[model samples]
Target: MKALHIITGLGVGGAEQQLRLLLAHLPVDCDVVTLTNPGAVADGLIDDGVRVVHLGMTGNRDLAALPRLVKLIRAGGYDLVHTHLYRACVYGRIAARLAGVKAVVATEHSLGDSQMEGRRLSTGVRALYLASERLGRATVAVSPTVADRLQRWGVPGPRIEIVPNGIDVARFRFDPLLRERTRRRLGLPEGAYVVGGVGRLTAGKRFDVLIRALAELPREYWLLLVGGGAEESVLRRAAHDAGVTDRVLFTGERPGGGLPGADLPSLTAAMDVLCSPCAEEAFGLAVVEAMAAGLPVLYVSCPAVEDLPPSAARGARRVQGGADSFVRALLRVRAEGAGPRSVPDAAHHYCITRSAAQLMDVYTAAVSCTSLGVSSS
Candidate 1:
């Protein structure tokens, strides 16, 4: 099948990485197209032999690009147009219909959990999300939480499909020697316990919360922050205010250019624990990566990760981080024999190959439904 995978920006993050993985590994019988800001993530797909289309819009609401999008889709004769994120879904769906594409699919990597904060824009997005759901041949969310979130927001239940974000563990596997070499290259201490968090430097990621939690931890523990965005300066100051500046490492905007982008896995293998203190996460991709690396995951009560460990089992350690509760969780995880008794099997759950197969099922199901003139229901 000829597939056109559209996203907002080709930056470094869970969704973008997931897209690269899917594009790189899907059967060669399938063709791929990516639409986004000209970024390293887009560059990565191109490197993998996947065709990418760069709109290079001067601003977010660049309507002029729509015609070109329609023209491209029509010319390419794509059987399916799979869009990611809000912008792509809304615009790509309309474009696909205009181009006479048969199936329009969308993947919800993250929903706008910050709706209250982005209230001014949320009203419009909610409407658009609902419309896109109706237009899409199938709607996919990377987790049950995300799919349900869409249902609560007005997307019909029949339209929602839960497909968790996946990783390529073979590509993301832990490598102690490589980890040491990476630390040395990055000028980090070889023996220090590095707690790593990789994501967009934005409000939802809650990097400030992670830094504050660090203040309550031992001085020897280092915090590694990756990626870049509007929240960079704020986080830098937050790190300083937490009195953990020396221990904080920020690697701004290094996107893995193609399939199995390289930043996190190497950095993760060097870490003692993978920490995600975000206020809300759609699928918690970082948590899965850490889990796949056999590292214990710590989060601020994310249902996706928190529920994995039974009332008493080897799962994530939940902490009400950035407050008294967070400090306690930090201390507990740091305590001898308090964290994961053994490293987890994080790889089994999130492998991209398996994820792709699962997505292919969703794709096949949706395409078959469309071919039969039926609904995803």
Candidate 2:
């Protein structure tokens, strides 16, 4: 079926990258529209031969974008309109209905209990979300935790589908040669016990906790932070204050470049272990991807692993209590030494093919329901 995906931005965040990966596996003709910031992922989509349009939306109240979106959707004659991220969902749903497209779907990629997309939820935000959410045939939650959060926000249980964020497992497989080359490229010393953290450098992600934890460890235990955000300077300052600035390495927004250490998989290969100190996570995609690389993961919270049985991800451990807690966990991990890299069952479970197949079912169901003139509610 012909589908159009709308998102607020095409930056190098998890949602944007997830969309790029999903499109490669989904068995349907699809195009993408970014309201603003058609950055790295947009280029990747273009490289993959996907049509991407930038709406040039200036701000949240860019009312002009609504009509342009409606015109695009109506002219494209798409069978389904799928929205991602918050702003896109609100505007996409309204535009889809105006464009005469009833089979709409939205994926709640970054919803937390108290925050969404790193922004605190207000009364008006919740009201607007629920109002627009009613226009869609289904709202996909990236995890059961997010599904529960959607239901609590007044989305009907039946209307919310749990489609976990997926990864290309083979792309993340650990490689010894890659590990050596990536470490050399990053100027990491031999036998360095790297403590890797992958995600946006945001305060909500609590990457500062990793910086603080880095100070307590030995000098050989290097800290490698992947991804970029508004908090980079703040995190750099935190590292400076913690006196681990020299040992802390930041790779600013690597979005699958051609070089060996340029992409996420190769970067993961260079790491000894991965730590995510963020207390709230929708799916903990970084943790799963690290596990796919056969790296043990220490996370403050990860619904993707927590929702499953303990045996699903044996290398993943949940730690609490801030920097001190992380420091303790890292010390324990260092004591145990780096083990053989083995992809966990959790990584295999969230394979991109499985997520694409499940999403196709959602698309088929939405179209079937629409043909019957039945309400998504």
Specify the highest-lDDT model's number. Answer: 2
Go through the candidates in order and give each one's C-alpha lDDT: 0.71, 0.92
TM-score of 2: 0.98
Candidate 2: C-alpha lDDT: 0.92
Candidates in order, TM-scores: namely: 0.90, 0.98
Model 1 misplaced regions, further than 4 Å: 28-36, 116-121, 256-261, 301-303, 306-315, 321-323, 337-346, 375-377
For model 1, state the Cα shift of residue 331 in Å: 2.1
Q: Summarize candidate 1's per-residue lDDT along 235-282 as a digit string, tens digits.
A: 999888888889999988766422445666677767777777777777
Clashing pairs in 2: none
- In candidate 2, stretches whose alpha carbon ends up further than 4 angstroms from where it belongs are 257-262
